[model samples]
Target: MSSAMFARDVPFERSPTTDLPVLLPPRPRERFGWPKLTTRHALLFAALVLVAAGAAFAQAPDAPPAPASEALTTAPATPLSVVVKWAPLLLKGFIFNIVISVAAMTLGTITGLMLGLGQISQNTIVRRLSWFFTQFFRNSPWLVLLFFAMFMIPFQVRIFGTTIPLPDWMKAIVGFALPVMANVSELLRGAIRSIPSGQWEAAESLAFSRTKTIWQIILPQCVKRMLPPWMNLYSLITMATVLASIVGVGEMLTLTAQVHAAEGGRPELFAPLYGFAGLCFFLYCYPISKLTQRLERRYNVKT
Candidate 1:
């Protein structure tokens, strides 16, 4: 082929004025469509909708005005003032809820890690027992578990001649942790199983012990796969902390009710106070959920 033909086929274009090859800028990657709508945006939109609905309901027509003397004597406190005054107390209870969630998650994760390993063990008895407990707790209702923990567990126990108090909140933590442990166990089992069997065979070929293979090779790979789901589970646990209130643990919802009663039980304050509690939870969990999504995308593996 002539040099002229090779020149004509060159990737770069020749400069018209100087007769020298000009390098073209690389083409930009094409994006397919509109920007993705994220979870945060969806949450904010839902919050706005709730706010609008609450405002409309608050402005709904009221009963006819009371007699002037009665109205002057019985005027209820403004809803804004009531919420603002009680927000700090409500926040303390909310912090307690966060503490319960963190404790439960920690306890659950540690226990679940052991259970997950058990499920994958070569011994038949250990595997079966781990599977049974995982299935039992995973399928049970959360509230029922809370009630069980509350009634069945003792109020206190003595160990080494020392009496230890077992408070309602501690029982509540146990209740929440049961299901979380089971779920984590399942998550881990699934993540480990998702790894290719070739990995196990390759480790065997290298004469690596099964335990060493799992710890050094298998589990490390599973971590990326497990993280996104684990974070999602944490968010769920955080939200479910509110359920502790039903069992008489003074979480945010319970405190909200007390605040309403303390503020004379004005019917108008009920919605706003509970709404405020929901908003707090939304604020805390939303970031976690957004991070989980990003991690899922970043760690996504193509088949």
Candidate 2:
């Protein structure tokens, strides 16, 4: 039958459960409000109410003034109003965080894919080497390398007995890039494995070349699967931009700290400065998060 061939057996039941007699609890109005109040109890209730009113009236004239800190608040604030006094610097700091994250992502993705492909390679040496690099970074401390990159890379970056002529920012980039690339590579490799093996065979049967198979077939499928994790990695990197602050780059959080310190240790003065940092992070990240959700729906992937 066509039903047997295509339609699934409707094992599900449709009849609703039989409704039983409802034994609802009584309402508060159904309960006695002032059950069995004696003359003394009635007098006590009235006396307490009068005492409360008299206390409120007595305190009205004696209420203390608001403190300077509480009185100075100007709420219903615009975001620009938070740092309009130093708008140029705050804007520059916000822009730099975005730029650094994009640069790190771009550098990280290209090298990561190559490393990931190598990690899954048939050759023992390539596999072992790739595995070792990925394991080292993934297991090691990110903060440690951050410091080493900013501080020690200067001495160790020499080429052929001469120090490498790269800027501090470049050193920071290189330092930040390695661990991220290693993680990205492993993430890609895992994602690729999750795709059915028949996909690879089908690509080959179509006479697609090795690079074509990877770029055209293998990668896009892998990307859909990897979309959620990729969004997470991007989110992680956006927060990781704060690491550059320790190396002297004045991104949002760093700028907030600097502002806080400059204002005589008054955390209140620049607390919203940190809020602005969080706001920038939200604006930068929320769109990609939404896109990741859409991609997940399109692919019908569980994760």
Candidate 3:
């Protein structure tokens, strides 16, 4: 057969015996580095290296000696030993941080969705108000907002003559949620606008109402576009949970501080303890970031 006869549209090769076109196998995806070295394995390896380094630093003979008072009162313990001893308590505090992040994200997403819809509303007042709020919270410093919530908001409220006390962490959630809501509002608005104008025209041509078109058509498409960024935002929120330590929320960092103080405020323990806290956050958020990258690639639009 001539080469012209083999120039077919389908991706296939001819089988010698049957003279039939055999379908080609899919191309293998390219992977960087070693085949068995996954992200999890790399992270675990890095953690081990960090632990080993910290141990070496702690036990180094050339390290500074403890103060006379501290040395006399408390027996010296290895950094790893101290960390292991308090791991349970530190972990409990870390769980609280996760809870705070989750609650804030949920509350923020709900409010943000409504606010986002408002930004594109036909009503002038609604659109302007939504825009204003979105800008206001989005631009404000997160730390300032957190501080405002802590001091300005009351510790309790009387509703229907029922006295309900508000805790510090609850206020912290509200503080964190405000910025999250604003950012999400902006995210939603941007995602909605990214859809081609032709889609709107097509939906209108079908006699689909604005609300129906948005809910049924535009939003479904936007979900994939929004997911990666939304997840990235959640990772940021999770890491920011450490800021709660400043306000005495008893998160991991705060507990770590308490542990340090309880352990005689040993200068040597400072780096390892804080480093461990950071590693916890890294392990948690790094996976989220990697997953976000994978999703972004998967859902990427060629156009």
Tell me the tens digit of each residue's lDDT in model 1 across 140-165.
99999989999999999999999999
In candidate 3, list every pair of residues with a backbone clash. Answer: none
Per-residue CA lDDT of model 2 for 170-272, tens digit only, reads 7667667777788899899898888888889999999998888888998887877776777778778777877888777767667777765664453334435
Ranking by lDDT: 1, 3, 2
TM-score of each: 0.81, 0.66, 0.82
> Roughly what TM-score does model 3 have, to 2 decimal places?
0.82
Tens-digit lDDT track for model 3 on 150-225?
A: 9999999999999999999999999999999999999999999999999999999999999999999988988998
Model 1, residue pairs in steric clash = none
Global lDDT for candidate 2? 0.70
Quote the lDDT for 95 in model 1: 98
Clashes of 3: 0
Candidate 3 off by > 4 Å: 1-74
Q: How many residue pairs clash in each candidate at the backbone level?
A: 0, 0, 0
lDDT of 3 at 57: 80
In model 2, where do residues sit more than 4 Å from their true spots?
Answer: 1-82, 155-164, 204-212
lDDT (C-alpha) at residue 258 in model 3: 97
Model 3 scores worst on lDDT over the 10 consecutive residues at 29-38
